[model samples]
Target chain A: MNMLRRHWPWLLVLVILLAFPFLFYDWTKGRHSGFVLTLMSEIGVMAIFALSYNMLMGQAGLLSFGHAVLFGLGAYCAAHVVNMVKAGTIWLPTELIPLAGGLGGLFFGYVFGWLVTKQRATAFAMITMGLGELVSAAALMFMAFFGGEGGITIDRVMDTSLVGVRYTSPWQVYCLVLAWAFIAAALMRLQTQTALGKMANATRDNFERAQFVGYDPRMVRLMQFTLSGFFAGIGGGLYVLIYEIVTFDTVSAAKSANALLAVYIGGAGGFFGPILGTIVVVLLQSGVSLLSNAWLLYVGVLFIVMVMYAPGGLIGLIFMHLPIWRAGRMRELLLPYARAFPPALLVLLGFVFMVELASFTTIGAAQGKRFTIGGQLIDTTAPMPWVIAIAALVLGALWLRHEARGFRQRWDELMEGSKRAQATAAPKPQEAVA
Target chain B: MEVFVVSLLNGLVYGMLLFMLASGLTLILSMMGVLNFAHASAYMLGAYFAYTISQYIGFWPALIIAPVLCGLIGAGIEMWGLRRVHQNGHIAELLFTFGLALLIEKGVQMTWGLLPVPYRVPELLDFPLFKIYGTQFPAYRAFMLLISALMFGAIWLGLTRTRIGLVIQAALTHPDMASALGHNVPRIFTLVFAAGTALAGLAGVIGGNYQVTEPAMAFTMGPIVFVVVVFGGLGSLSGCFIASILMGLIQTFAVVFDVSLADLLAKFGFVVTSSTPFAEILTVTLPRIGALLPFLMMVLILVFRPRGLMGTRDT
Candidate 1:
């Protein structure tokens, strides 16, 4: 009971993971709901990828712009393995196919890390960017291996199996992905406690001190980079299995940007931050794409806010409130939240209106769709819509600013009162103790 | 011999264009220590702006107007966006620029749609300038070389003979010391950014017609430009020049050569069959890997010499 209490978070996560498929299966009825399963699988895969990225960014303090090379190589390797299996050259379980990608990642990481590890800081970033671009370009030009712009595809329905169980269901694939994700994440966590990982952190904090302590910073970086690449490759392998195709987009700079976004938004400092970030980002991407094309704009704005005001990230912000919450002073701030709601809603509604107007003018116009407002068909060809949007934007900004000031004042007053109450109550308690 | 001569001329022209884009980038990167990810986006904007202006006036007028517009945009971005994020540190600044790049790309697509624009070379430079062993060379390419050379001369003189140029040179080498010496460092940074962006704009104005103006143009050129900047070393104009020329020549010559590793191996009495895994790689010719060579060189240079050839600092 004490052990369970100590590790309740881990136990809770395990239960959640095991119960997810059953819940999903029940929700989807008897029909094979591949979309949700595939999305979940992608989320797990991306989580691993994002965590690998955090190893470099958070642990090693290396900011890479081209981390997709490992992932792409892993995908390509998996594709090749799938082809081989289909050709009856090898008999391996579908669950074990991702290992090929991991090996491929390891091989490339060893080779590339040897070169990239020589440079630190900005130089390292530029070198990785160059290598990433080179590989992606090569993927397009070299048709034999990369299959050109068309990419390479392989049939996943192969009869070759070690356990005599044909991999036909999406659930099986999801289970396999979950298993790998768990293993990869656990190993990565363990790595953080190891000697090399500690040295990597040391190098990140102060290279000169690490060198003085008899550890080569370059070697430490190389080891961490290789391991990160291995995990990234596993993610890529899962991607290929889910899609059954690998393309240049897999290794593009945009994909690297995606990984960066996930890590930053999720909170790079925390181990489980990437998982949170991956889930949020993937959901936003898949969900918001259906409603509007301006989701990226919102993400951009959010990222800027995080960088400027909340550098520790969403989790960090939540953690910052722990002292207040524990002291029971949080209740006093409820009125401020109530006062802030109307203006916040106005700002959100105005922002959404502007985004919708812009999207309507661009993508909607291209699709020949008519704009409608309150059941009245509004002509988008007129400038009235644009004028209204601009007005709303300006008005919304003004309201937001006013409300923000009011919110700050209310918060200060509440905090001051709470502190006074605590101080007065402390004297009474002390007197009683005497 | 004919192919070599043509390729050489073509390579030189392309090299000059690459230099135009890379020089400003090197200056900004070394002096500011911020890898502006939106540099290529500025180039793309220049092309689009030129196309729009050319529609109203002519290509010649648009050429001048486009770069000015780009400079103003750069100045605005620096003043409003970058300066605010500068307090956050290098990574935040980089991320901001990256986000800006993404916005620019999507914005361009939204504005212009997803098709290549009809950006043609000006009528004045439409004809052939010369014949290299019966093969005609475009006059536009000669014009590019002349303009690039003129810009190079201006930069050289500005850096060597002007007072502001000397201040910039000092700042490039020692940013902190220069700032401590009572120079308006922020103003200089903004000027450098605007100037660099203007150069990129000019490159786009001319090179867009030489290449193509499209939504994908930024992405296609962004990496190669970065490679040139890195391979040449940060803050070294001479290194940028040499690397640009080398890359241009390599790319041009690679496309002309069709030999493969397998073919070379056969000459050495090693006959490899097609069934092997290595065979796929071995059979790839030089031309096919042209796009990847610059990046390969960049990686190699970074590994062996992070400071680059003629770079003052490690980056």
Candidate 2:
């Protein structure tokens, strides 16, 4: 009962995730929005990808600029495997395709890890970047495996499912993705409790100390990298199933950047951080991108802001408020938060305004896109909108600065109170255990 | 012989331009321990800024102004952005710069549009400077060479001769002690960063017209510059210069050479065919694999010599 009570939130989240697509269901057509389903499936695949990335950045203290190499190669392997199954050269259940990808990832990860694990920190990052470039270049050059620029295509409905479900529809595919996501996430979570995971943490904090404790730091790194690759490969397998085609772009620096962005923006401090980050990143990519050409600009600014201010990420911010909530002083900061919201919103709107205006002036003009607000078109050539945007940005920034000071003061007070209460409520220590 | 001479000259011009950019990156990275990922973005900005400015005044004034503007922007980023993130650690600082690179790319696209700008060579330098056997070498290439050489000489002199240069060197090796000695390390950091970015901008001013000025120029140039830096080793300007030149020659000559591994192997009585296990490796021409060479060299250099050639310390 206690365990159930403690884990109820996870159950709630799962229910929410399952119910989300139905919100956009078309009853008349008896189907889900292809766009929404695909977007959600993308989120699922990317969530797994980001989590795998965290196994390096968050757990092992390794920053990779080319994680997509593992993901991409695994995808290529899976694509080839599917084609083979279709050709009757190989026999495998549809559900087991991701395992083949995992094996592929493990193979490459082991090979590449041998080269990269010799170095640590900045050198490792540089080497991985070079490796990423080399592989990407090879992907374009070698037409046999990577299928040149046209890429490799496969049919997902191979009719070889162990569970006897032909994965023809997006719904079926999404369900498979969900099941796999859960399995991968749970396995990854359990792995963190293992000795290797703890040792990986130890090395991350202090490699020399870890070495003193009779562990090879390089070995620890290699193991972590290989395991991470396995999970990332599974994500790549799902990608092949959904998209039906895998291209050189899958292995590109930009794809690696996607995983990095998701991990960083979501916060690398906690287990659920990358998942949170993946959702936000995917939404911004799919949703916000449809609304504006300057979506990349917004994502960039957000990333910078998070790095500068909230390096702990969204989860970290939430965790910071935990003590106050426990102390029942969360209500005290409501007023300050309310005061800060308007200015923050104003600043965001103003920034977006300027970006849109600038974008419309160049890219928009070429595309014949006029800037609009609430069904009313705003002239790009006009000085009025520019002045308003500038005014809002400048004024809101100043206002936010003022409100931020108040919020900080209130926060510190509440946090100090929480600490004091917890200290006083605890039993005092005996002098000599008499 | 004509191809050899022309390729050498072209490589020299390209290498010098790379040095102009990579030197600044080398200094900033070594001194600050912050890899300024936006270094190439500054180069792109310099190109776009020069293009716009040239349209109004002329290329000469644009050359003088664009780099200065980039320098000022670099100073602002260091003071406002980098200084604030310095307390967070190197990873945070790196992420900050990475985000800045993305933002700058988007910003450039928004301002300049998606198309390449017509940032042409001035009429004075448009004509042929000399004939190489049968082909005429453009005077603009000669101008690029002259400017890069002058800048290189100036940088070498400044670093070895000037008092500020001595101070910078002291700080680069021992920042905390330099701080304790009351030399204002933060200001020096800002100065170094600005100077480095300005150097990149100068390269952009020359290189943009030499190649093409577009949004994608930064992405294309960014990785190759990094390859040069890594191959040369971190914190070594001379190494950077050498690596740049070597890479420049390799890339230029690789395009000229049509020899494949298969052809070399055939001389030793080894045959590569369609049925071979690694036929792609044997049959691919040097020119076909030109893009892979620099990265291959970087990876090999990193694997064999982590300190890089002439590098005084480990990265």
Candidate 3:
């Protein structure tokens, strides 16, 4: 019963994940939003990738810029292995193809970790960046494995099937991805509870202390890094399985940045941070990018604000509200938040207007397209639009600041009251137990 | 010999430009431990600022005005942005700058369009200064060398001779000690950041004309500048200078040469064809891999030395 209680949350998550496609089956009228499945599958793959990356950045405090090298290599390996299976040379089941990718990731991780883990902090960042660039350059130059920019394509379906389920449909592939993504995420989360995980955190906090405790900090970093690479590779393998194509872009700096953005934005501080981050980022990448050319700008602004104000990310923001919610004082904060919302919306609209005007004036002009959104033309060259944008920005900002100050006062009061109540309420609980 | 001399001159120009950027970076990083990821974005801004200013007032005035504008902007970022993020620790500060770089890149794109600006050399200096082996060396190239040299002299004198320079040097190497000894370290940081950005702007004023000013230029040049800083060693200007020049020469010469590893292998009685194992990587030429050289040097230097060429401490 205790074990069931401890695992109920994970089991619930698993149930939701398993039912997701079926839930979509009704929404999409029996075909399962094949597009949605593809997108969700991509989210799953990126989630695993970001989680593994967090192992190095968050747990080990190693900021690596070239992590995609391992990821890409694993993908390439998986692709080759799939090709082998298709050729009937390997005779391996398609289900276990990710293992080949994981092994490949491990092999390269071991090699890279030897050289990279020796340096700490900033030097490590630079070196990894260089290594990433080096591999990318080589990836383009070398034609055999990387396939020279066009990348390697594979057929995930084969004569061999472990469960006799043909991997012909997007739903089937997605289910494969879901199962692997869940397994990978669960294993990585479990790893954090292990000795190696604790030691990794110890090394991150204080190198000398970990050393004093008889753990070689370098070895700890190396082991953690290698394992992280293994997970990243597994993610890559899934990428190959889902997309059936892996290219230089897989290992490119941009892709690595994607992982970084997800991990950091998700909150590298705790488990499931990457998962939340991956969902938001992938959603933004697929959804927001389709709407505007300035999606990156929005994401960048969000990241900067998070770094400046809330380093704990989205999950961190949720965690911060837990105490207030527990004390049943969450309602006090709602009105203030609602009051602040309009100004925030005004500011966002203003910023968007300015960006759209500027972009329309330049890039849109160059493209010979008018700045029209939903049949309304924005006369970007006119001064009125610019004036309106500036006014909205300035006025909204001032109003938001005033509103925020009011919220802060109320927040402090509620927090203090809760603290006082807890102080008085504490002994009664102990006395009741006695 | 002629190729060697021309390559040397070109290398020196490029290397000096890199040093101007890296010197400021080394000081800020060593002192604050915040690797300002947006440093290259500042350089990009400088070029754009100059480009816009030059259109209205001509290049000469833009040269003086753009850098000052960049300096002031840098000061604002330091005073408000970096200072606020500093309390969160270096990683947050670094990430803030990284985000700033992304935001600025978008801003630049929105303002300037996703195209190269029409920033060019003044026609007065566009004529060839001299010819070596039938190749014309532009007067602007000579002017670049002269300007960089003058800036170098100014910087050298400023750092070694001025009162503010001593405080800056002290603050750079030992921030806490300098702060404890009655110097305002944060102010020094703000000043250093402004000066660094101004130097970057100055480089942009000249470099924009030499290389096209575009949105992508920041990213293209950003990594190379970082490699120079690392290869030169952290907290050492002279080392940065040496590393920059060396990298510049290597890049210039690599471009000039058409030799490949295949030729070398053939000379050693090992013939390579398409069938040979890893033949593509083996046969790729130095010129083909020219872009990878600085990155390669960075990795090798970091792996072996870690402290860099003359760095007294590990970064």
Candidate 4:
């Protein structure tokens, strides 16, 4: 009980992770469906990638638009290692192959970081973008190394294992991935406590002040960037091990954007922000992509919304509610929630209809399909559906605005009451609920 | 010699096309401090719009209407989307633009399908305008050069001769100071963004048929345009012009002069037999790396001269 109380968060996380596969397996009736496991593995890899990105963006204040160079290099190098092992040149454990990727990433980071670290802010971003483009183009040009557009693929069933296991199972791979993810996360956590990490934060907060304090901001940024590259490389190596393919797309600007999206959407300030972001992003990617081809448009819209309304991210929004929730004021806001529900639902339904209408007009029209709505097949060729969708969108938006103002007003009143109650040292059950 | 002249003229045409795209991007980037990743997507949209419009209307009408539509889209994006994101800082704004680019590319694909749209040169401009020895120069290429030159002159005059242009020029160097001086910085940003996107759209209308108007066109042209902008520096139109020309010439001339390291070595009495490990590397020619040269130049320029050719700022 004492241990549980002391490390409750860690215990809770561990329990959830371990219990996930079993719960999913039960839900699917033990069909050997490995979708959740695969998704979790992807989350694990991307979590590391997003964390590494944050190490530069959040800590060093260096906005890198091309961090995928390290990740892709690591993947390519790992692919080569897999090939070498398959060729009987060396025998190594499957789990340790990602270390080769880390080494490859470290090597390139040192070289590229040397040149890139000289510039700051926008210059750094532009230079990194240039380097990224340079490498991706070179990857396509050099067919020997990059394998051109077709990309390079290696079989993971090498039959050589340190533990003498054939390593054929997805569950086995998942275990290895989880172990590495935990180790990487622990190391990253430890890194946050180091002097270099502190200096990185100092540089991010105010470079001029850090320089006045006798620390070179550029050096701090470079070191953080290189280390971030190393971790990203580890993720890349894991990527190859999971998918067994390395392509130019792996290191393209799009991949860098993916990391940026994950980190920003998750929240940059918190340590576990990237992990949360990776989970949300990977889930949305897998789930939404299956449902709609316009997943990217939705993602773009969501990102724009996040950038505008919620700069701190989903996690930040949750954290923002903590103080109010802890004061037992959340109970009082149930009335506002009830009042807000109809308008929110109407807005959501209207928005979904608009998106569907747009998708039907473009993608569905191309496929030569008609949209069915409310027990009637609607002709997508007609402008009536479009008119209705636009009307619904406008009306719903107006209603949502009105409801949102009311919700805000009610929330403010509850919060004021909660603050007053807190000041009087009331024995609030809200803290326990929180 | 004839091939050289043809290549030079071709390079000049391509260079001007690139300048049409890069100049607007450079201006927007320098003025707003936002590297709009969707700039090339706007170009792609322009091409698609022109192609669709030309199919119904005429080419000239399409050219005029498509760029105007692109400018409206740009203005709308800046006012509603980018303005909202600007508060989060540059990185967020950049990411927003990146997402916008992806969405635009996908949206273009969704609307136009995956195939390349057949946007052809007008009948009036389809014939050869001049000949160099046996090589002929198309009237379309000449038209492109003329339009780009006119645009360059107009931009130069607008910046130097007009009050708004002077304020924009000042913003290019000192955006904070311009804002402090009571200029409507936001309005200026929107105007610059709209103008930049219009230029990109114009490039698309001209260059679409010159190249290929495809879904993959944005990806192909986006990086190269970025390379030109970065290599040209942040706020210098002169640098942008020079870099665009340099990139175009390098890409064109490289394709014209197809010589490999192995060929050079062979001229020096060096021979390599078959089944050699280094033979593949030795066989790499400049022409084969045509797509990579501009980016290589960018990296070299960034490393050696961080401020670029005529850039006053570090970017």
lDDT of 2 at B44: 96
**What tens digits encode model 2's per-residue C-alpha lDDT throughout A1-434?**
87677669867877888899999999999998889889989999999999999999999999999999999999999999999999999899999898888888888888999999889899889999999999998999899999999999999999999999999889889888888898899899988999999999999999999999999999999999999999989999999999999999989999999999999998998999999999999999999999999999999999999999999988898899998998888888889999999999999989999999999999999999988899999998899999999999999999999999988998888989999998888764665523
Candidate closer to the true structure by DockQ (higher is better), 1 or 4 = 4
lDDT leaderboard ranking: 2, 3, 4, 1
Q: Between 1 and 3, whose lDDT is larger?
A: 3
Shift in Å, residue A140, candidate 4: 2.8
lDDT of 1 by residue, A207-260 (tens): 999999999899999999998889888988888888888999999987888899
- Cα error, residue B239 of model 2, in Å, equals 0.9
How close is every model to the real structure, measured as TM-score?
0.91, 0.98, 0.96, 0.93
What are the fnat scores of the candidates, in the order listed?
A: 0.48, 0.84, 0.89, 0.61
Q: What lDDT tens digits, residue by residue, belong to model 2 across residues B1-315?
A: 999999999999989989999999989988999988999999999999999999999999999999999999999999999999999899999999999999999999999999999999998889999998998999999999999999999999999999999889988788899999989999999999999999999999999999999999999999898888888887788999999999889999999999999999999999899998899878999999887899998888888898888787887
Off by over 4 Å in 2: A1-7, A427-434
| Per-model CA lDDT versus the true structure | 0.84, 0.92, 0.88, 0.85
Over the stretch B43-73, how does candidate 4's per-residue lDDT look in tens digits?
9999999999999998999889999999999
Predicted candidate 3 versus true structure: per-residue lDDT over B51-161, tens digit per residue: 999899888999899899989989999999999988988788988998998998988998898989888899889999999998889999899888988988888899899
Better of 2 and 4 by TM-score: 2
Regions more than 4 Å wrong, model 1 = A17-29, A79-92, A140-166, A294-298, A341-345, A367-378, A408-434, B266-277
> Clash pairs of candidate 2?
none
TM-score of chain B of each: 0.98, 0.98, 0.98, 0.96
Every model: Cα RMSD to truth: 4.0, 2.5, 2.2, 3.2
lDDT string for model 1 (B146-186, tens) is 98999999989998899999999999999899999999999
Lowest summed lDDT across 10 adjacent residues in model 1 chain B is found at B105-114
Give the winner by DockQ.
Answer: 2
